[model samples]
Target chain A: MILQKISKQGKGELAFAGSLFLLGIFVAWDTSKMVIPQGSSIVSPQTFPYMVAAFTSLVGLVLISDVLRGRLGTPDGAEPGDPFIAPSYKTMAILMAAIGLHVILLEIAGYVVSATICFFGVSFAFGSRKYLKDFAVSLIFALTVYFSFTKGLNINLPAGFFEGVFGK
Target chain B: MGNSFSMLMDGFQTAFTPTNLMFGLLGTFLGTLVGVLPGIGPALAIGLLLPICLTVNPTSALIMFAAIYYGAMYGGSTTSILLNTPGESGSVITALEGNKMAKAGRAGAALATAAIGSFVAGTIATLLLAFGAPALADLALTIQPAGYLALIILAFATVGTLLGESRIRGLVALAVGLVIGLVGADLQSGALRLTFGNLNAIDGIETVTVIVAIFALGEALYLASRHTLVNVEVLTMSGKAWMTREDFKRSWKPWLRGTAIGFPLGVIPAGGSEVPTFLSYGVEKAISKNKDEFGKGAIEGVAGPEAANNANAAGVLVPMLALGLPTSATAAVVLVAFQSFNIQPGPMLFQTNPEIVWGLIASLFIGNTLLLVLNLPLIRFWVLLLKIPSHYLYAGITTFALLGAYALNNSTFDLQVALVVGFIGYLFRRFGVPITPLIIGVILGPLAELYFKRALQISQGDWHILIAGPFPKIIYSILLLVIIGPMVWNFKKKFANKK
Candidate 1:
């Protein structure tokens, strides 16, 4: 019965709202457990967090009720394209995975390797046909940025594997 | 007036130095480059460059940042005109008639009018900022913490209501941002709030990471997802760079009108450039001698919205410069830049660092003129930027996004934060939740809380002090109206419909 009710309404919006509400509750609960130092200030550090928690919970409730009342937001003027159509979940998953992989590999493998892999992965996910060309372009692009930041900008990018390669 | 003029002249002197001029030019160039590219705007562009700015001189870095801010405004109209894709929210209205103009093979005229209108409006708005900012700063000094709190509330109401499809969703996004903003250790009592026991969370989330994640990475994911579904055709330019005599005659008045409409609205916290551009388009259509040309490629249409768009960009600087209040997402990122430089931007900023403030104001004029020069003769070069394949473009952007995230504190954890935030940003985009309020909330939440607490402290925990005094009183009245006005209107409409 609950499943049917949720499915009848905007499922995604409801789930998001419910998650936010839960998050608000967690925040409030967590804030309540915090130990404030004696005579800290007229307004305790917990005060703002509690207010934020309350506001978040209130908004979450309002959103939930609104969604239940069939006031689900239409995506007109919010973005350029029609919002009713489902985006390509496969591509999204691929991109997300690529980003996750990049994050995991960044420090271990260094910027050049991880960035190239990420660039190539993203390009492939976007339907680029030429794998060889994409790989070459990604390598060049990553290296260029790496050198620019390291040499030109004086900012340190991780050179994890390259440290041994460059005999550093 | 003489003092202001002399100070502006001093500003020009600072801005006209060789290095500063180069920074201005470089900023305008990069700004246009990013603005012409789809899926990136000035905020991400600036965010990407924030790390680099840390290594440079503060004044020059600021000049370039300011240049990029207005420069992107000019370049955004190019994509809107040629590809029917708005590079930023402000340029969305330009796409409506601008794309039509491109299709009608008046792409040159449309581009020219947009460039010229931007130049005019930018100059006029900078003039306003130059003369008006100091006076406004002086006035802003009188505002107490309560008044400031009320002002922040007004900003929240305006930003929440004006952006997104529903105010509830906007507020929800804002609340989420506030929660995120509250994650670090509390400065007042030195207690951790939402760190989850992570050492990196001690400093909270970096603003650049959040911005780049939401604007760049999130946008790339959305674009990649929709890549197969949407096919955009870049319109080719076929005419001279200059607008015809007739086009010129029709465009000037609309340019003036757009500036007039956009500047005040920009100064106010009412949702940035979208409203003004649409307003300009409507006004132009109403007053146009050739009304039929509006939808089918009207020069007036291009001129008005483009002017409003640029004017609004300049207008956003007023509150940012004078009151240290960011009215838009880009301004919020700029606020981060200011904080990073250890320079607090508020009424005191003007008095403390007139050189940086005035120099930045002066650089806007220089950047505007340079943008006009670049856009007019180098139109074909910018058009060639469209020839880059989508796959490579997006791939490059993604790489930069990751690089930028990783570069922040050299911690892999920031990258992880970025990925998570990027996913949430994608969800926000997919669900039609506006990202602007989230950004505004994240940046402004802590500041608002500080002021709110200060106000209460001043009154020894009296809640009524929040609405005390004339300024806070006036602001609360407006806030009440803003919150209740729309509800009453909707209720009345529903009642009438039932009757």
Candidate 2:
């Protein structure tokens, strides 16, 4: 009870439920905008979406009531997670930035460089301080995957800096 | 159906080929490799390997997939016993007694019983699958579209209400998946429903990408945020890694009992894997003479649930092969594997693709024997995999997940989609929503909708068709009872309290 009060998870859940409600409304709005071609259609494309919207909104309301009854969502650890420990937003932010960089620079910097950076950044986020080892492993992994795909699978990956070195 | 024996013999003929046998071996090893990783389950394991399934022979590949499915079961138990940590949800109960046994210096007995129990249950259940699937497929063919509509409704309802701690949250998660699944064009009309006017969105989100991104990539993101890495003291096995005579006496009954419980639960859509596993554990606990030794490492506790987990896995394939229903997350991924090869697994599957169906069934038996023989000898090699640091394991997963998602259509846009979906997955975990329902919903929703509309079309817009057939009538009646029975009980309990 004391942890619940300090965590304020009840309020956070209420907000989440409210957002689900809004999502329901958005789905309804999207459904209403659909232009159904004229026919003797028994169940149109919009039928399932409408049902889904109603269900979503109804469940959202039910969740809000559940929160009102002091029921809050329990944090889970599908992996080996310590739910009591506060999440490291700094680590998550770094992870996001790393992935974003990987996506954007994948074409320009190539699969090996971008993937290596992604892997390195992710390792750092997970509290790996050994930079040289992490980078070396990451680079080797990316290279093996890239070459395996290119040669064995016959899939072309962007060469970037190594353009014409690996092949056309 | 009487010729199922001959068909099985034919299946063995196909599965025994050197190439297929090699692939099955490779799959088992790869499966165990992924299974030992901290957060990777068979769903994510199978999803990562989808790219390879495209190029490989379907029969050989399916044989491999079936082996992977069984191999992960063996791998999960290994972790639970040695490290006091479950690699997957199904093995959570295994960690309870198995780990205690390990600490008591009986790690070998625990490992042996688990491996043997799994093999016993797996072989028996695969027999049930082999004989029962054809008969059930014949039965499934008789069921009308409305019956199918009722069945999926049952799937959605049970998956929504029966899973997780909160019914509201599960249903809400299912609703979200339905919405996401609806993003592609309508199945029959081909009218785009929620494309939001994007040119790329017309083809709908790729299931493989979503599965990989959410299960693998999303999991990595969630793990990255958790910050703390949990490492248990890995127990060293000694004193002969084989079960003693007394250990065998205690374990055999539970294995048989666990098979009975697991196979039936797995056959039905409502029987999510956790139930049978936990049910097996509870049943063993209730009936055991050594009940006092339960928490301290009773061999019955290890044997029953481990058997149930494997049998339930085999059982899940029944409905998936006979009727196109996937009850659990792993089943959903396997269903996707069949679909990836443009093979829709239904009553017609055996009629259409006998080799793939029978070959997969035969491979299950082969894999069970393969693991039973192999796991004991290779226990040390498998244990060494646990030495991989959590940070490096997760780092490698992140890279592979990104690559897997990127390879889907070779579009950077899909990379962004993967990120967004992975973020959603992270949020779902933070809120304690069971994700299996969400995956089941996304994969099964469209099919359910198609069945519903087809049922309606058959009746010329009459809604009563849903409850018309005997199957639908029976299904809906049972579902109604399942839903309403609790409310009535609560009402009476409240009245009694007032008195």
Q: Write the per-residue lDDT of candidate 2 for residues B368-405, one digit (tens) a residue.
A: 89888888888898888887887777878888888887
| lDDT tens readout by residue for model 1, B362-449 | 9898999999888778778888887678888888888898888888689988998899888778767766688888888888898898
Residue B324, candidate 1: alpha-carbon lDDT: 91
Scored by lDDT, model 2 comes in at 0.83
lDDT of 1: 0.83
Candidate 2, position B187, lDDT: 66
What does the lDDT read for residue A52 in candidate 2? 87
Candidate 1 accuracy as TM-score: 0.95
lDDT of each: 0.83, 0.83
Which segments of candidate 1 are over 4 A away from where they belong? A1-9, A75-83, A164-168, B227-231, B484-499
Model 2 chain B: lowest-lDDT 10 consecutive positions: B490-499
